[model samples]
Each structure stands twice: as C-alpha cells, then as structure tokens.
Target: MNQNRVQASEVAPRAGLADISILANASLTSVTGTDMTSNAQGSYDLALKYSGTGLASVGVADKKVLVYALPAELQGKVVGGATVDIDANLLPITPGDIPGVSLLFGALGTAIDGVDKLVAIPAVKAAFDSLSTIQNLGAYQETLPATVSPDGKTISVDFTQGFGKYVHQAYVALFDTLRDTIAAIDVKNPIAAIPVKLLQEASADLFAIIDAIADGTSDILDNALNANLLGSMNGTLHTTVSDPGVASATVKAGAINNALISADVLTATEQEGEAVTLNFPTTAVNPIENYDVAAPVITQPVAGQTQVAGQVTLTQPIPDGTTFEAVVTLPDGSTKNVPLAADGTFVVDTGSLVDGQTISAKVVATNGTYTKDSPITTATVTAAPIENPIADYNVATPSVAPLTAGDPEITGQVTLNQPIPLGTTFEAVATLPDGSQLTGTVESDGTFKSAGVDQLAAGQTVTNG
Candidate 1:
C-alpha cells in the first residue's frame, strides 16, 4: 500500500472569492511511491478550508456550490459518501434539496422542536396540523449513491442549498420569533406564549404526529421527498463562518473515502502539486432515481411450534434459479441439512430425538442476485406413552361331590391361553347350595378345590362349595 498527502494550506482563493485551501490525504493500495495502477481500492480523508476576504459577502441565505475536478483516470468509479454537518454559527438554517426522505426527518425534527416551544400559538398549531398530512404518505426509501458524476471526475458540494436548506426556514423563523417573544413576556403573567389550555392539546398533537409516523404514514412523505434524500449525490453542510475580514472554518466531507475507493481514484497518477480546479454548477446534473430490491420471505414451518413427528414444508415459493437449503439443529448440539423434495417438504425423525429436547429449522435461499434466511422454527421432543400387556385366560365348570355326612368339597379348573408367569397365584370362592360360601386356593396347574359343602332340603341338591 502506498500513502500520499496533498496539502494546499496556502492555496489562494479566487480574486473575489474566499481564500480556500484543500488537503487530499489518501492511502491507495495500488499506488506505490510515485507510480499508480488501475482499479485499486483506497481510503480518502479530504479536508478543505475557506477564509479571508469576500467570504462575508456570501449571505447566510445565498447558495454556495463547490465542485472538485479530478483526473480522468478516476472517472466513473466513485461510490459511498454520507452525513450532514454544520456549525452553530449558522443560525436560521435553511432547507435544501437533499436526496431522500431524510430531509423530511430533518424538517420533522425542526417542526417538533418548534411545536414544543410555540404550540400554544394558533398559527403554530395550524402549521402542525398541516404537517400532520404526512401521516398518509409512504416512506420513500432507497439505496442512495455517492455524489460523483457519470464520468467520475468531479465531486460537487452545494453548501448553501444542501446543508443550510435542511434547517427549515418556516419552523426556525417562527420558533425563533416565538422564543424571543417568550423571553420578553412578564414572568407574572407567563400565559401569553404558554397557554394553559393548549398545553395538553399540544402534547396530544405531538404524540399524534409521532404515532402517525410510526404507523407507516411517513412512507408517503418519504416517497414525496425521496428525490432529495441524504444518500443522493447531494453535498453536505460544512459550516457557516462570519468574521471581520475572513472566517477560518474546517469542513470535512464524510464517506468521501468510499466515494474515492469505489471510483478507483487511486488508479489516476498525478504530481504532488498538480493544480485541481474547483468549479460551481447551477444545478445537479444527476438526480437519484428510486429503486428497490425485495428480500426473500419465509412462510413455512411456522415459527414457535411443537412437533413430535411430522413433516414440515416450506410453504413460501422460491424464485427460479435460486438455491434452497433447510438447516436443522438437533438436540445433541449437532446441525444437519435436511434434504427438501421438489414440493419443499421434509420430515424430521422425532423418534430419534431425546424427550424434552428442542430442534430448530430454518431455510436459506440464495440466488445470483441476493441471499436470504428465513425465520427460525423450533419443535420440542415429547416421549410417547407406554401401556402394559393384557393377559388371556378362561374358566371351567366346577365338579361337585356327594355331601356324605361331615365330608363336603368341590373341585374346578382355571387355565390361561398363554404361558403362566412364574410367581402368579389365584384364588376361588364357592357358593353352597344353601347360599353359604367357602374359599379355596388354585395351583399353578389350574386346579381349584374347596370344602364346606352343606346339604339342602328334598328339592335342593348338594352343590360344589
């Protein structure tokens, strides 16, 4: 990498213009010593100073445009510069033709500040009411480019129109006057600029404005102002200097490095003291056009669900030429890619997952243009229930013996359709002919024997007991 610093601290301004000096400091990788190459990236930290005679003649409201003409080698390769800055000396800031809805935000901030201070006045209230119309507009947002010409040889800065213009004249003028008025009012009355009744209403109006903007109404306003948003090739607001003969001010153009690197400015070789001319144009030749690139959306395997065993399908349609992959994180801290069928469905084997463990899945889609990852969907593992086995068995009729005096007994058999478990036991209860009962134990062979069979009357008979 080669580094160079072009310092022109004593450069004389135009005969009638302010004395201006520019210092260009950059480190381009392709530039080694005094030689340079083509298409190499580099960093730029440029600073400019304007002072001396005739600077006072530039009125606060007047527009000041500064243009830098670079070598032809740096043409058509610039990109990326941003941010708007200003000095406190520049009071009553003016609005500019910024490149995007950022102007609206800037103005919105001023309007909010003004409303905070002077909302008690009917006129301020009316202006706030008018500003509320922005609630219906769409936010006009897009990718903005660096301020470089198509040839990439010139970098322009419209100081007065770009920076000063961002400070809303309407809000600033109105509130500045109101603030002065409030400062003059007698402390005893204090009610002229700060009305008691309108105080609550003003707060409500402020909240309403914020709520409307939050609810997407700013899109309309954004779109309306998209033509001049911050990222556009518009210049930044450096500072306002006012002195007897001259005002020394250091102005830094942020993101200009990206612009230089993107444009391959390092490829252009120039001597240390080569004269770089600064020109002024009445209008910006290139106005940024609004464009949008939609990001892929994911709608399948809905996020936040529990699954025991099932297939999760990617319901979202993938564009042609785009590649899709499903990433699954398993319970054991391992990740795997689940293959998807043509229909975008893939089943996860929950049986393999441990109980109480959670698995997550997401889809990544990539194409020549861009890549996108879907929101993560997770499923918890749950164990299935367990059931005991049922036994198959049958019972046989009991055999009764004659009740001979004191001896009375009954025998029966109980068998199982399957093999008998080793420690299994059974018992039987017999009902006598006289409605009495006796108990007995059954052997593993399935035989049952009992005693205490009682005799019955003539119509009754001895029954197994």
Candidate 2:
C-alpha cells in the first residue's frame, strides 16, 4: 500500500487556448504539501503573466480563474475527510475596473427570473417536477466563496481530496437516476399533446451524449493525474473557474474539462515577455506490509466420463476468519478463479480445454494480517471416455391386440432387449386375414396403434413385421 503523492510539477499546466490572450504566460510554478487532519493538503502555486492586448478586449472582467484536484484520480492516494480550499490571492484583475462584470451578473439574474416564471406554469411545473424527482435539474455546485487578492498577481490553488469525487458522484448519480426514471415511465400516455414514448426516446439520446461527456471528462481528468510526463515538459493540468455571468462558471461550461490553467498561458506569454520560473515539488508515502504465511495444500483433479469438468479440492482445512481464492491457469494462458464450496471442493471447468492440455492451479489464503499463496500444482487434463454408438438390431417380438372390445382398431407393442436410442422410430406392417396390409409407426418406446382393421378377428392368426 506504499505510494507517492502525484506532484503538480509532474503535470505541467497547459496555458489557456491560444485565443484566450489573458492567459498567455500562465504556468504552474510549484506544488507544496501541508499536514492536514488525516493527510497532507496539496497546494499548487501558479503564476500568470499578462501578455494579451488587454483585459478590456477579452471581456474577462471579474471572471475568477479556478483550479480543482480530481478526486477520482486520488481515491486510494489520499485520506478522506479533507476539505478543499481556494486561496483568495489568485484573482489579479480589478473588480472596479470591469463594468461588464456587473452586466454579466445582471444577465444571470434575468435568466433565473425567466426560469422562475416558466416554473409557475402548471404544465411546465409538472415537467420540471418530473425532472427534479429523477435528478437535480439544477447544476451541481459546492460554493466556497473566495475574494480577489489586493495586488492580484499571484494565485495559489489548494485542493486536498474527496470534494472532486463528490462532484463526480453527483453527476453520475443524476444521469443514472434520470435514465432509470425515463425507462420506467409509461410511454403510451401523452404529456402536452406529445407522447411520453417520444420523451423516452429523447431521453435515451440525451443519455448517450451524457455518457460520452462523463466518460471523456473522466478520462481527461485521469490522464491529467497519471500522464507520464517523465521527460516531456508538455502536460495538462485540471482546473475550474468562476464568473459573474453564470451560477458556477465550471458548471456553465458543462464541467472543468475546459478550465484554463497557467502552463499554456505562461508558455505563450513568455514568448512575448521575460522567461517565467517554474518549480516542481514531490512527496512520498509508505504503508505497512503484510507478514509472510504458509501456503495451503492442493488436491489433483480427474475428468469424469459424464462431466465436462473435474473436481479440484483443498485437502487441508482452513482456520476461522481466513479466506482462500483459487485460480487455475490453462495451457492456452487463460486463467479462471474457482470459488470453493463449504467442503473446500471446486470444479475446474475443462470443457473448453483441448485434449492433452495441461493446467496449473494455486490458492491464495488471506487472514486478518497476511496473505500467502500455495505452491503451484500442474497436471494434464484427463480425457473423458469415448461413448460407443447404440448397436443396430431388429425388433425381437411384434404382436397385435384389440384396442377396445368389439372394435376393429388395434394396438400393439414391439419389444427389444437393449436400450433404444431416443427419437428412433420404426414402420410397423401387419397382414390382415383379407390379404390387406395396415401400417403404423412405432415410437422409440415400442408402442403403436393402427386403425381400419375391419377384417381383423380376435384370436385369429395375423402376420406382422
């Protein structure tokens, strides 16, 4: 369980898109760790040098830059219960100078007002309620208010762990709930003159897009954390942003996949100004190792004539609070884990194993403190006995009898000493006293019936084959 914390230096933050001039020379300088409640707090220091035409030209006034750590990527690396904090020193643009920032906030308020009015309509309210019950129609946000720095030149982004995963879970849960709800709705009913069936279809299409966005975003986040930038300076940093124009800038953009980081901004701005310095920091973590233990005993398996597989047993008994997992490796290099029964017996399915194929098996035993694997046992799969085909033979005895009293129709049975193959049928022919032949099919069980035996007399001699 020993591991090392991933450093921000390992992943260089790419500058915002080339079109975003304000972020021309943005780059991560260093990442430092501080002891937190359960684990260390990850702090990333980034510097963005202004190299654009001007903040006035970019319409970015009062727009706060954001940086977020991906919790999905840090699951086993950090302890939970750590709070995420954003330092107030990252915003350099002056709030008073940006008049458009007010306009942006005003526009957002107007949009909210419009939504409130729409929700007042009975039909609209029902639809909205339906969506809300399935999932939060509103965007997911855990607002942590941060103020602009007085000087506004240096920005430090610190996110410990857990929060990003919570956000991710919220998103996944929303989509999953919505998908399930839509699937359960009765499609035959009409809502607002539109068939509910159509809504279900539209939901399926929407889910496809959501899945792509969710999976792609997760991949980008994962790549940002684990990408091997061993020797290359090019790397991607995960980030988030806040702006007056939207409830949560990251949510408005549909997620942090499009957040602006300093690496690319720094690189681009440096080409226009002086070189910016970059620093990388790293930390190590170690976990306790398990003590060595003894391996379990294994028993060989034998293929049976009727079964496609063989039974492999654990001859030795296990102690309480212990568990064992057995894995079998076939000659083709495929491995299968077989679960043991209460008696410690497991079936090694060799139906797919070719003739003369060899197999090896081992058992891993785990107690409260340690896990140990048993010695590998190898054996050739035993071939099952070949079955002989049913021998061909003629019916030993064929006889006829009256099916009912005073009736010409008759029923009879043929006899054989050996077992009859299933689905086997035979044609039964009988010669009546009038020299006419009556024929019927004999079932595999040797039973048959025939009609139109008008000349048949009881107790009279009749020929049959």
Candidate 3:
C-alpha cells in the first residue's frame, strides 16, 4: 500500500508515561494528574477527578471527556478532534454534566469553558428531577458576584480561582434569559410605552450594581425589574418531576433589557423608542383569516397610565389558514419569531375584554414568551341567549277571536292561527224549515260541510245563513 494512503496503524508496543494533567470541572476522583503515551497512534492514559461543579445542585453527572488541543507538543500534527476509548469499567456511561467528561485537561482554565456539551438531556432531566420543588417555584434573581478592582483602574481578573463564579454567572445568564424570554411570550407587542420611572429605576439599579462590582462587593438589584416575570408566562409552575421538557415545562417570559427600554428621540419624525406597527405584505403565504389571533384594541390614554395600542394585522393576506406568522423586529438586537395565530385586532371571546383585562394569546414561534396586553376595548359581553320556559310562555303568538255560533256557512274552509291538536271537535248544527236541527258529520280531517237547503224562513232573512 502507498505510504500516502492513510490506514489505521496497528498497535506497536507499550511505553512510559507522557505529559498529561487531568483536572475535573466537577468533583474529581482518585487522580488529579496522570501520564499516558502514544500507544502506536498517540493514545494516552489519563487519571482525572470530578474536581469542580457546573452548578451546586446542578453538576455534570455523566462521565465527560474534555478534549483539548494536544498539549502544544502535538498541536500542528494533531487531528481535527480526539476520540478516547475507555476501559469499560472506568466510564460505564456518560454523566449528567453539561460536558460529559471523565478526564479534563485544558492548556489553561479556559479549556473547561470550551467543553461544549455540558450534560445530556437524560442526565439533565435526572439531575434536575432531584430539585423539582425549588425549580418549579423559584424566581430567577440576577447574580451578585464579588469584584476585585476599583474604578478608573485596570486589573487582572482571574476568573479561574472560584468555581462558584462560573456557576453564578451561568445562573444569572440562564435566569435573565429565561425571565425576559417568557415575559414576552403571550402576545406580539408588550412594553411599548414603558414607564419612565421604571427605566430610571433600572438605570439606577445598574449603577449601584456597577459600583458594588468596582468596589469589590456584592452587586445590587433594582425593584424596577419586573417582579412578576417568573409567573407571567406560566414559568416556575409545574406539576411533574421532570425538566428539559422544554415544550411542556420550559417557558420564556421577557426580554426586557436596558437596550430595549430606551427613550431619547433622535430622528425628526421618529421618536427614539417609539412603538411601530408591523404591517405584513398582502400577498402572504398565509392570510389572517386562517389564524385565530384577536387582540384587544387600545383606547385613548387612561388617567394614570399611558395607553398602548397594540394591533397585529397581516401584511400578507392570510386566507382561511390556521398558522399565523410575523418577522417582528424588537427594539433590542433580537427578532420576534412569532408564529402565533393571526387573530385580527381583537382578543378571543374575551368576555368583552373591557374590564382592564389584558388580551394575551399563545405565541407560536420559537422564544415567544411575553403577553402583549394593549388598551382594552369598551365593548361589553352580555350573557348568551338561554333556554328558559318562562320566556317561551310569555312570548306568545298574536291573539285571535273565537268563532261565533250564529255564523252561517255551507262549505267554507276555516283555519286557526293557533295550532289545533288532533282530537279537537266541532260541528255543523244547521236548521231546516221543518224546525229540526240539520246534522252533518265532521270529516276525519276535522272539517264539516252541508249542501241541501233550498227554501227556508223567507220572512226571517237571517236564518243562520
């Protein structure tokens, strides 16, 4: 075979130890340092520990392997990635870690950060299942970490010292991302006219937090932060023993950030933070009729609050389709992937939706978590028509007078506006010149008629004719 033709080299022989140092991101086992040799094809032995943590109650449980750039010596010649064949007993299975690794050796501390796959879904589910109670009912507060530097000075920040720093930062990122994402889920447009007071307070809070970080202390949080964000999009509320359900459990709430909440008019015609309407093209792939999206119409400003008029109309003519879509551009560097039902301009059967009731619909696209509650319509919702006997009785048909007994007729038809039952009886009791009562049988069809009466009471022109 040609030397250039690549082939799996056969195992040559065993050798001495090589330069290797394995540090566990989580709690480690027996070995913190070890050595391995090129077993014919650059294979090495590694002794590692579960030395660190991903998060406190949240560590990688599975046996993970953090592959690194071949320790400088084997850098250029090393292949794209490495594959480790473990002695089945050493790593029977993968751990519940973010990065499922057994042996972790980084050129530096940053190597752990590069470990992409932290933990698998099964592991995450298993691990999080242990904290079901707290996970289901906890508010994600922003993280407050200790600082080491003062203002107006450059300092070498060592992020590698404490494991809690990594975990805390991760928690903050996770919490904030989740909180904001979920808050923006229920409707299309929310937080258009944010309270100026809220923005100022948030800015103050950030300033205080920065001061703390610069002065080497815990960071500060502001009350301006949306306290109800966790519960807004139905997050922090679950009834099962599983997480990573993502669909049934994982919820995004709000994306309210400093960037999204700004208020300085820059352009002549455009206000700095004006809420703009999203018009879709009339020639759309889906029309508005197909969707069941209905939002509350915003009215004039209220006494103490600025009314935000939020309406989601289809730029594209949504025919009788079911799926609604919009490529919304938010104030922040984010996109609104709204695949919500295209309910034109009004919220659903919203009991009139007038009582300061906010209109919120399910968001369809990925990462939709906020409720778009606009100004409520003034229309009221009355109770639907009911089935009651009293109503039916009081509302009767037009009244009619009963037939008289002196009326005369031979073969005339009669009719009653009211319905007559099958057994109703009537008779044609006529009289002849002989003074005997004229008899005529009534038909089964409830009709009676007579034909013979030539001469009768001539002086009495009115002989019951």
Candidate 4:
C-alpha cells in the first residue's frame, strides 16, 4: 500500500472535503495523503489520515476527523494517453466495512446537510444577516474578557476596550426606550405587571422604573404635606382678629383647626361636600371682651363754629372714672392738651386764641392702652366789637390884627380833645365886640384854624357851637 499517495485531483476538489485539518494531542495536521490497495482489477479500498500537530499551549489540540467513502460509478473512463480525460461522478457506498467511522461520518454529514438547508431558507438567512449586523456593531464589537470571581457568584467584565465610551451610549439608548414605553402606558388603567422574561432580562431597567415610581410618589406626598391646612387657618385667624367682634371666635376656631390637623383628622386638601367645623371649649374665654371701647366722638363744639365765649363742650358722655384729654390745634400751628371734666365735657380757654382765628380740636380718651382719638372739630374765634370815638371841644387863644378899616380882625385856633369827623365843622362865637360866629373845618390832626374872623379882638374867647 502506498501510504503517502496524494489523492487524485478529482477527490481533492470535492465540496466539504477540501482544506480540512484534524487536531490530535494538542496539535493540528492536514489530511494530505491517502493509503490505498487494489482489492481487485478496477477496485480499490482507500483510507485517509491527517498528519502534524498545532501548538499545545494555544489549546488547539486533541481533535480528530473520520472519513467515509462511497462506491459509485464514474461517468467517464481514463484515457490511455499521458493526459487523462475524466468527468464528474457521483458515488454510492455501503457502510458495513468501518462501522464506527461510517456511523460518525454519517451523523456529521447529516448535521451539516441540515444546517445547509436551514441556511438556504430566506427567513433564516435574513435572521442570520441581522445577527451578523448586530455582532458587528461598535457597541457589541467592543469585547471585554470576563473573569469569574473567587466565590463564583459574580463575574467582572474587563473595561480595557473603551467600554464606557461605547457601552454608555447603548445603556442610554436602552433607558430612553424604557422611559418612552413607560410614558406610553396609561396611568388610569396601567398594565398589571411587567413580563417576567423582560424583567429577568432587564433587571436594571426594572430598577430604574421602580426608582421613577418612588420619586413620583415622594413628590406627591411632599405637595400634600406642604398644603398645610392648619397653617392656612392660622393666617385666616390672624386676619380675622383685626376685627374685634370676631377675634374670640377666630382664635378658638384656629386652635381647633390646629388640633384637628395635628391629630390627622383633617386633610390638607379641600374636599367636596365636606365642611370643617370648629367647636370651642366651654371654658374658652372671649378674646375681645374689653375691645369694645372706641374712639371718643365730639359733638358739642361742632365743626366750623365760632366760640364767642372761648369754651368747648363734648356731648358724648364718657364712662365714670374715665378721664380724657383734648388735643387742640391752635391757629398758630401749636398744640395744647386740655383735660376733660368728669362728664366728658372739656372747656378750652380762648386767651391764646386770636380773634377770628380758626382752630382744630380732637378728644383723646386717656389712661389706658386702648386710648383713641375722636374726629377733629374746627371752630373760629369771635371778633371783638368796635368802640365809639369820644369828642370834646376846647377854646383857643385869640389874636387881633389891625386893619385899615374901622375894626381889627380877630383870628384864633380851636382844639378838640379827640379828632372830629372828617366832614364836621366847628365854630366860635365872641360877645366882646359884636355878636359874630367863626367856623372852620377840623383836620385830621384834631386842630382847626378859624380863618376870615372879622372884627375879632385880642384875648377873645372862641367858643364852638
């Protein structure tokens, strides 16, 4: 038998039998030759074996291959010339001669044919193409060597291949998809549960979902807690207390509301068709019992009145033992305080008030923290009456001048104790020489000159009529 005989070129080109290597003892060798012997004319039994070994350290070892041949007719015969002419042929063989090898080869060939048929299917081919594309993706192609932990419960993935740069994008994309899916779910009628397989496959994503739900619940609770009904009621009570009549009620109501909220009996949110009733305890004291006192009202010396007697009176009666003071604003812009009498009436002296001057006065209840002022009242001072002027007539020294005629003319000036009226005339009569009258108009200086006095003698007494 020629053990190193190369196979005829016809067998070398057959599909699934080309360029095959079988490994043994941690080494690889190619099936480069065949052992054959002629059992009879035109008949042969052949056996194939691989030779050589690969590196044991690389883990490519202890591998073997089995070959089986089939007896079949050739379509063409070899010519007797130097160049042989042959045609392609198909063969059929009986497998009883090397049952072990035949069975193994049969099983492997069946499996390969089945795989070939599956790959030929269009849908399967498309699925394989998609898988190939995914495998080639930048994110997936970045591989990490996996390491088992010491206790075998955890595996660590290597991060030497720029894992964060690529894998983070994939993680972000996955989370975005998950967020969108959750957002599309209707909260009113949400799905009962996530699919178990999906949860198992994406536990990280499920954790994210749980976190989102927890955050939303926390926000809702925060908002509810912040809507403090007790606080709001307290504010309302503060505003209501400004009105003295409702102060006691508002305070009691606020206390009750606070107690209810503290006891969790009241919700922060307003409920429809429900009212919060605040009941005060029987022993609760009224807050505004002493707040009934008000600012005094002045009615006696009415506004815009002239006080001839320079006194003011208040008509509104005060309680017994309640003393009040009046703030009087004089016309000169100065202020004075006057005490009220026991009857709530106050008198203001007009000594400081000028005639015809207007003054403002307001009454302030005194001797208590609740003291308040009344509305301002205005009054004018009375004008003084005019006095009549007095008049007195007096005699003046007479002077006589010698005239060319028979009698000398007498001239004299008369004076009055007070000035006379502008249009009044004064006259003097002398009885020494002749009965004659002398008259002159009085001037503003209370002096009068008697002019054109004819036949007037010296030292003659001049009298006015």
Model 4, 1-465: lDDT tens digits are 344454453354321211221212211111222222222121221111112222222110111111111111111111111111111111112211122223432333343234434333233223323322322112223222233223222112222123223322332232343334333433232232333223223434343433443444222212222211111000000000011111111001111111112112111111111112212233323222232233343333433443312233443333322356777776668777877665555555534445567777777654223455666777656545553433443434433333333243334444454444454554444443355665555444444454565644555454443
* Regions of candidate 3 where Cα sits further than 4 Å from its true position: 1-340, 343-371, 378-411, 414-465
C-alpha RMSD in Å of predicted model 2 compared with the true structure:
20.8
Residue 233, model 1, lDDT:
25
- Residue 430 lDDT (model 1): 74
lDDT of 1 by residue, 1-465 (tens): 123223454454322111221212311211121121111112122323212111223332344333444454334323344222222122222222222323443454454455446434444444444443432211111222224556654554444433333323322332333233323333234433344333334434443443443454433223333222222122222211111111111111221212232233222222221232322222221111111112222223322333222233443333323456677766776777765556665555433445566777776665433556666777655565453233433444455444444454667766544455455567777776567778889776767788656544444544442
Q: Which 10-residue span in candidate 3 carries the lowest summed lDDT?
A: 234-243
The predictions' CA RMSDs to the true structure, in order, are 21.6, 20.8, 30.8, 46.2
At residue 201, what lDDT does model 4 achieve?
32
List clash counts for every candidate, in order.
Answer: 23, 14, 70, 8
What would the TM-score be for candidate 3 when compared with the true structure?
A: 0.16
Ordered list by TM-score, greatest first: 2, 1, 4, 3
Candidate 4: pairs in clash? 23-63, 26-61, 26-62, 27-54, 28-53, 28-54, 71-93, 410-456
Model 4 CA RMSD to the hidden true structure, in angstroms: 46.2
Mark the regions of model 4 whose C-alpha exceeds 4 Å error after superposition: 1-310, 314-318, 331-334, 341-358, 366-375, 380-449, 453-463
| Global lDDT of model 4 | 0.31
- What TM-score, over all chains together, does every model reach? 0.25, 0.26, 0.16, 0.20
Model 3 over residues 94-156: C-alpha lDDT tens digits? 111112111111111122122212312233233323322233222222211211112211111
What is the C-alpha lDDT profile of model 2 across 1-465, one tens digit per residue?
A: 123435644675554334442232333321222111111112222222211112222221213233322211222222111222322111122211123222432332343234434333234234324433323312223333322222322122222122334333444444464455445443332332243434444445554544543554433222222211111111112222111121111100001122344454433433432222322222321111232223333344345422123233544333323466677776778888876566555565555545566777777666445556767777665666675444565557787764433567657888855666675568788776677888888876787776777743457666678
Off by over 4 Å in 2: 1-62, 68-258, 266-288, 291-358, 362-380, 385-411, 414-465
- Candidate 1 error regions (>4 Å): 1-309, 314-318, 322-325, 342-354, 363-377, 391-410, 419-442, 450-465
